[model samples]
Target: MTTVHERARPAAEVLEWGRATVDPAMREAVGALPDPVRHIAGYHFGWWDATGQPSEPTGKALRPTLTLLACQAVGGDVEAAVPAAVAVELVHDFSLLHDDVMDGDRTRRHRPTAWTVFGTGPAILTGDVLLTLAVELVAAAGPHARILTSAVLDLLGGQNADTSFEQRDDVTLSECVAMAVGKTGALLRVSCTLGALAGGATPDQVARLGLFGEHLGLAFQHVDDLLGIWGDPAATGKPVHSDLLNRKKSLPVVAALTSGTPAGDELASFYFAQPEFDPARAAALVEQAGGRDWSRERAAQLLRQALDTLNVAAPDTTATGELTALARMAVDRTH
Candidate 1:
């Protein structure tokens, strides 16, 4: 049994490689920006110190690792997938910046969020710049161009759906699944598709890989929901019960509320009433509703489904071993 810490070590190394590619590309892009725009973008990507000179810490770069691993799983050179990997990660970061603003989240990865440090206007522009960078990088990938554009469209659609669900009282599980597929799953699916595209995989092979990534992404979200409730603050780099405080409509909360337990009823009633976000009350609600356990079970099932699909997609056991390891690590992650 690989511990989450153990799994994260290698993923960290993978992230470093992706990070190496980003800074140089960012340098090229930043030079093209006007002075004030340049400063904001530089700070956002961690290329500048608070005083605004060169420094570093471009964040975890997890999505890029997924992109590279998908490429390798299809026997493509990881180097060939660098453009796509960078694009995906930049897109992910863009979402994170905007999400922080919308959620009123002041921090991320233990540092002030872009919007918190820069003003909301600058942070919004910074996110827009990153989105443009993603598009430009993806466009540079030539033959796989469509994958990038499609991912962008899907990402926007997902974000819209996620916001729409927040106000509605009657969101179903299936609807949530669709939203997840678009929001979280879309880029993940594209990572695999980009890999196949880079590797010159057959059309059928590309389709299967997309399906594999989609399932893995669904499982990833399930696990994330679990951690948001139960994960330790030290390990996760956020306050415990951050999602509860945010009133995020994640998988576990949805499942528990709909499951018909006494705890569930209490939760649903509390949620409908829109009680103030008290950390103690939120934690109690999660415990009472068995949200954590329900979410863990769902994550396990989705992981199994993902593995089953991978078996069909890449029959060569040796070829897919790394990717299989990554899939297991994703669902089993604590943070």
Candidate 2:
């Protein structure tokens, strides 16, 4: 394992190290699943193609990296945090599986989605299996099972709200933000919280790190919503103007709809008028209505808040620097 003091590795390198450290444990957990479910899970995880041949794995390993780093930041042994790391990663993947199915997404990580290849039922079942595995893995860790289950419940609530928003035009910015907190922030908060617990952190330290994760998670969603509008298809593995195409009332879109600017009115007209509206024009309207700028500014602000919380936790100096690097990389990415 790479020590934080060994050298100042880039955030990307830290992520790679985190992934490498957790992969064996992750694989072992997955290996315990029934064969059919395991096959779909492996396919979704980029471990193999539909035919079971080997394939290059994809994923930034962000959640698990946060878990390990949070442990190290609190002066806990990284190895002690491995199960927590794997557990969170499983939960993340489980969400992705369900998200793709619910969103009608055809691709992820530049490959066809598991639902598209293995059938929807199988994909959903695999997600359920993975989520079960997460709970089972964490059951031995004191307090971790309860923490993870609570986060899962919150995540489900957020997903429910997200789906419900699609049928209505009256979604408010606050409501949308609350939904993002559940949909994205819950798991991230738990990632840090569980890691801190595993590392034997003080209650105050755990709470502070959890706060940091909450801020970072919301910031991540803001950036993700931006990318959903303008990110390159090659990088995001989604269609151009994907959010607009789906008419998703994402943060920026909701901001624009509620902006009360003429551009906002026009965007609303375009958005709710018909199913065939132009996505590019809608993107332009969102920017004109200040949605893009607002989201960008909010993400930057939240990044600062997250860093402030991290500092208040009084973490190890080297781990603090690496965690800061990871947070910046997360907020500043193109995809």
Candidate 3:
């Protein structure tokens, strides 16, 4: 059992611990894949370069960390949640592989995307394989499988809406919020739910934890959208004003588009125009139209709500503190 003092470890420490606990199993799971698919998956995971040589690792492992922590929060053994953590991480990477292809993105984690390095069909097939692996990992656990499948369906629906928004000019803030909920919140919610279930949480406890994850997930999206526009390339591993360059109908962009301000109007004009419309100027107009500040404030509000829900969930003291710290980190991060 983790002592109170040990449980009170800092958020970064907790993340590292979660990574160490989950990575071996993750690697083992990937090892079972066919050589070609495994190579592409490994490259996408930053486990190796395209040549199959070991490389520096990437990803924050936030979802899996949340899974482990949520299990501990409910007074369950963290080891029992390892499979769940691995499954969630696989699903996440699967989505990323497909997303890069659909978004026409050429880079990820400061490296060429799988679709760019390999062929698009190969990258997409690799994503399918990873998703199938995720399902196989939990196939024997009926409730767990159901939970994961539900979340995946929601995620796919969200991705569909997101892609559709690119060709649209009339996306509302509410619609954008709904999309973020499905795309980001659904998986995060499932991470906590699966963890709590593995830890033997009461139904009420699972519900409360799920709510916490949902709110935090939405908050995470707000911060991510902000980073997409303004974050440093070195930190974010993406170009400056990347979202603006894509004319993405992100939360902030949608907010600015619907703000009823003159800056918003100018932004709509600039944003919907042809390519090469000056991403820096588009970013400035988003800020001018109050999108940036609104997103910042919304993120803070959601963080508070998430913490408050977590407090009511009757989690262990150590879990509460660590979860609080992680929640804050999720919103406060620049990348």
Point to the candidate with the largest TM-score. 2
Tell me the whole-model lDDT of each prediction, alpha carbons only.
0.74, 0.91, 0.90
The order of the candidates by TM-score, greatest first, is 2, 3, 1
lDDT digits (tens) for residues 15-57 of candidate 3: 8888899999999999888878999999999999999899987
- Model 2: per-residue Cα lDDT over 1-335, one tens digit each: 65444554689999999999999999988987888899898888889999999999889999999999899888899999999999999999999999999878887888899999989999999998899889988997665799999999998999999999988999999999999999999999999998888888899999999999999999999999999999998888778999999899999999999999999999998697786988999999999999999999999999999999998895446777788999999999999
Each prediction's RMSD to truth: 3.8, 2.2, 2.1
lDDT of 1 by residue, 28-145 (tens): 7656777666777667667776568777676666566666666666677767777777778778878888888987888776667777777899888878888887778777777666
Return the TM-score for each candidate structure.
Answer: 0.86, 0.95, 0.95
Which residue pairs show backbone clashes in model 3?
Answer: none
| Candidate number of the best lDDT | 2
For model 3 the local lDDT of residue 220 reads 97
Model 3 residue 282 CA deviation (Å) reads: 2.1
For model 2 the local lDDT of residue 21 reads 91
